[model samples]
Target: MAITSANQLELLQTAEAVAREKMIDPALVIEAMEESLARAAKSRYGAEMDIRVSIDRKTGRATFTRVRTVVEDDELENYQAEMTVDQAKQYLDDPKVGDTFVEEVPPVEMGRIAAQSAKQVILQKVREAERDKQYEEFKDRVGQILNVQVKREEYGNVIVDLNPGEGVLRRNEKIGRESYRPNDRIRVYIKDVRREQRGPQVFLSRTAPEFMAELFKMEVPEIYEGIIEIKAVARDPGSRAKIAVISYDGSIDPVGACVGMRGSRVQAVVNELQGEKIDIIPWNEDMPTFLVNALQPAEVSKVVFDEDAERIEVVVPEDQLSLAIGRRGQNVRLASQLTGLDIDILTEEEESKRRQAEFEERTKLFMDTLDLDEFFAQLLVSEGFTNLEEVAYVELDELLVIDGVDEDTANELQARARDYLEAQNAKAMERARELGVQDSLVEFEGLTPQMIEALAEDGVKSLEDFATCADWELAGGWTTVDGERTKDDGVLEPFDVSLEEAQNMIMTARVMLGWVDPAELEADAEEDAELEEEQEA
Candidate 1:
């Protein structure tokens, strides 16, 4: 193919046609043509020459030129493309080393092999331009709901046409066993858009919790207008879901707004989700109150929340136990997800039995440690004295309030409790010493004798070892593994150590060992205080 006057106008027409077909810029196609033509010209004029091609956008004229760069005498290498400073006199006057010399060259006639190569280069550039366009168009559309048409099914994945690009809905992302044929229109959530090696990948999902939330936003005007907000969503996909919503407008009931008149709005979302049942609960700042609403169709007798552990215990009547738990614990699981807490459901009878057992155990501890009779220990337990430390350090007035306990009796009780604790502490210290615990750890201010003993048993015998421990390792914490919460036992957890206290103590140890600068610690504390004040403001 020759770049002759007869075929000159055809280049622009071909470029525009390819650009329209690929949905890319016409300039990109023209640039690709320039490059492919340049490569062919280089092959004809000798590869060592600096041949170039430029097509005029207005007249579709191909202008061929050869560029030779001036260089220093010693740096000259290519005789066709470069000229030394002294050898460049014929081209121009005062030619600098970095200057380039250009002259018009005759266009090369592309042979069969060259034409084939040019075609491949144009195709490659057009494909790259198309990919870049698709990525830019869809990157910001993630987390949105889109109506797409299914193009085909590969394996079990559904390939959908996004008009400008293609999206993929994997089998696992579909609701239940929902299947679709070619040209089946479906609503999907744009889960993610990624630029991959082959091209941009648009991953769509119908089972995402956000998909249900987006559906409600489309159906409910209040949610769309920001009057009502979807706080959280938990889905079982094609089975059941729970959504927590809050309304900023006092006049609007979030649950009722979502339910709509005669359940019209929620029904639309349900139909789209393959008839999945949804529970719309009102959002509350109080976690327990919100959980009670989340676990609906069941009565809750009591709720005990452990804030530190992020766990909740719910007591219900025996008949309501199975209802609260639902079939295979689905109700409680959804409640857990909604409230961000691990939930344990129990019958009222079971809770009562557990409380009675705790009471009995406390009574036994008081009886054995304080040298009190059974009735006296029971009285102390009823007064909320669970441990000897509380009984020993409590005000004299608190002990006097117990029945038949006078000032003398209170003093005597405190004396006995203090003496027993001192003895226990001494025994723990002796055991810790036997285990080779160092004085640096024993002399640490925050740790008790029993804490030192526990540390020694756990092989944290030195100050360095304690300083290296993580805060969660000193204060027992719950870890989520494989979507299940597991307990991590801490050495000092039995002594009721808190995570903050553990952190402070470890920092102090590091400072003492010269591992951390005290000034830096002070600065960090000041920075944290400022951040807290800003948040409060």
Candidate 2:
């Protein structure tokens, strides 16, 4: 609507106020005000009229115009939006396509409804601008700590008021036993800023390990200045945590630097976390050495690793077992989390007993499964035979490499293993058939009879079901429980197909059943190129 000079200045002042309140740029607010006023002007003029408006950012002066584009007679489909060359000559100007013409449209007074409509538009624009600002500002601050005041709690989630916008410290991300009242000051790490249907969602976290690290950065000047680096951290949250730090300057001790004078530095962070204990350990590139450092005050006598299983066996002195394992296994558990290894703690005596037990168990297993005598079974167990799968999966050439097993004996041993496996598979196939296993699944060469039965039990009994099975599901992969790798001993050796083999088998099944076109699979290759093109556009 048309506005007097004083009214125009008042509108600009209102925009500035909204911008200040919303923490957005004032220019954007002025632009929104201009747009709102232009829409109101359109209501006063005709809805079909081509209307445009501009506001002076510096002087708060408003301008309005009824605009038209000069186009060829054939292009003048909308008479109100476009003007012809012959008609432009009547106004004494050069008539050409793509030329914009503007005529001053006197500003019109607004009714109550029009004023209310303008107010709604301004509010919407303010919200959109605020979302944009929050995204732009907080996106870069991801993983950084910011102190905020608790505004209120919603549905068990704490809402904290931040500089630009509010952030939600989600229920699960909060440390245990920590509670807050309104206006309580707390620091949180900016975990994420994501756009949602409602608006930008600012996610804050106090329980992330990175949050503890960030607090160390703030407290330790060496870390903030890049003289020291925080390599890794693991937290039991609100109870205990471990941090590994490395110093570039060899003269400086990373742990001592983090601990500060009389532990003041770490104690500051602990105070903020409600007395969470921090273990500052020196980091080492050698993972085993780092694990030793992480499990400080508890000596490790010996360390054995099973790389395939991603498990570590640590042997400590009999007296150190309780200390190394901590109260209820907290020490070993945190060490495992820090080093990214699954650790099993044992005393030296316990480890020796376990070894002897394993040896006896393996000797008996070889004697029974491979039809070997006590002498041969002892030889096989002495050479590290843990189970029947080891004998079944060992190469014939590798078997020749073992001591005391001559050519004839190795051949006989392998033949016995093969015969036993065949007999087992025959029985498994019979059971799978009794369970109504699909022929398509049974016909697949990659799956063993045991796997076929397992698949059938899981209801993957059709070719389509087999095709839909993920590679990890079809073959096998490790899962974790509380960050420790679960002992998934199924699907061992040749019968356990690689992911590529699983994918190939699924595609072969799909092709044989005429379920998918070969061309459709080929089209998946162009998907990345198409996505890049769409992103560029």
lDDT (Cα, tens digit) per residue for candidate 2, span 271-323 = 98878888888898877678888888799998887654456888899988888
**Cα RMSDs, all models:** 3.2, 6.2
The TM-score obtained by model 1 is 0.90
Which candidate number would show the highest TM-score if scored against the true structure? 1
Residues 37-81, candidate 1, lDDT per residue (tens digit)? 999999999999999999999788999999999998888899999
lDDT of each: 0.94, 0.83
The runs of at least 3 residues in candidate 2 whose Cα sits more than 4 Å from the true structure, single-residue gaps closed, are 5-24, 46-50, 56-61, 67-104, 148-161, 168-186, 195-201, 285-289, 316-318, 346-357, 386-468, 479-537
Local distance difference test, candidate 1:
0.94
Task: Give the candidate number with the greatest lDDT.
Answer: 1
